[model samples]
Target: MARNQQNELQALQDTLYFIGGKWRIPIINSICNGNKRFREIERSIPGITTRMLSKELKEMEMSKLVKRTVYADTPVLIEYEPTEHCRSFGKIIQEMIKWGESHRAIVLKKRT
Candidate 1:
């Protein structure tokens, strides 16, 4: 492949790897939509098990996609918020949502 094509391919691969898992994007969307607490995030995404959410959050923190903050209160509270790096991907996610809606409409129209 040409040098430019190789670079583009690598970038696409990185993006795919980042958003590879079934839970990652939904987790990000939940957090970005103001679901900070663990339970809140869990409830926002139906069909995600407790174990999966815990595992995904840890991985996301390691990837610098989310910040886990623990508040020392009478009852300790933990919250997860999207990091600046993750926030940068918000526009792309929005576009994907738009595209998905449009694609579904087209497919349904064809079936009709």
Candidate 2:
């Protein structure tokens, strides 16, 4: 591969390493949209088990995409929110949404 191609491939790989997964984007969307509590996130993303959500949240936190806050109280409150870096993904997510909608329409049209 040429030097430019190699650089582009490396960039893509690094991007995927941070946000590549079936659940990561959904989880980020939920948190970014103000679903802070753990239970709220689980509810927002149907079919995600507590164990899986917990693990994914930890991974996102480590990646600096999600911020985890804990409040020491009678009923300890823990919340998750997207970091500025993750918030910057809004445009990308919107583009993905538009593509997905168009793709779904095409797929449905073909099936009918």
Candidate 3:
């Protein structure tokens, strides 16, 4: 393969390694949709447990998709907010959501 093609393939692989997970997209979306607190995220995603959410948040923070802020207080509160890098994904996710909804409508209507 050409150098340009090889670089492009590697970049795609990195992107997949970064965002290819069951929880990453939902975690990003929840943060984008205004759930910053840990509990808030847990509540926003119906089936995610505290442990899994915590792990996902930590991973996102490491990947720079989310920022973690801790307030200096007697029981310090931690909030997870999406970084600019993550905000860039908003348009993509919006398009995906539109596609998903359209597909769901067609499939469900066919089923019923």
Candidate closest to the true structure, highest lDDT: 1
User: Higher TM-score: candidate 2 or 3?
Assistant: 2
TM-score of 2: 0.88
TM-score of 3: 0.83
Candidate 1 lDDT (Cα, 0 to 1): 0.91
Please tell me which model should have the higher lDDT, number 1 or number 2. Answer: 1
Clashing pairs in 2: none
Task: Write one digit per residue (lDDT tens) for candidate 3, span 1-112.
Answer: 6999999999989977877878778887889988989988899888888899889888878888889999998899888888888988855777889999999999999999
Give the per-residue lDDT digits (tens) of candidate 2, residues 4-96: 999999999998887777888888888778799999999999989899999999988998988888999979999898899988885577678
What does the lDDT read for residue 68 in candidate 1?
Answer: 94
Q: Estimate the TM-score of every prediction.
A: 0.94, 0.88, 0.83
| Worst ten in a row by lDDT for model 3 | 87-96
lDDT of 1 by residue, 1-112 (tens): 6999999999999999989989888888888888999999999999999999999999989989899999999799999999988887876888889999999999999999
- Give the best candidate by TM-score: 1
lDDT of 1 at 110: 100
lDDT of each: 0.91, 0.88, 0.86
Among residues 3 or more apart in sequence or in different chains, the pairs in candidate 1 whose N, CA or C atoms overlap within 3 Å are: none
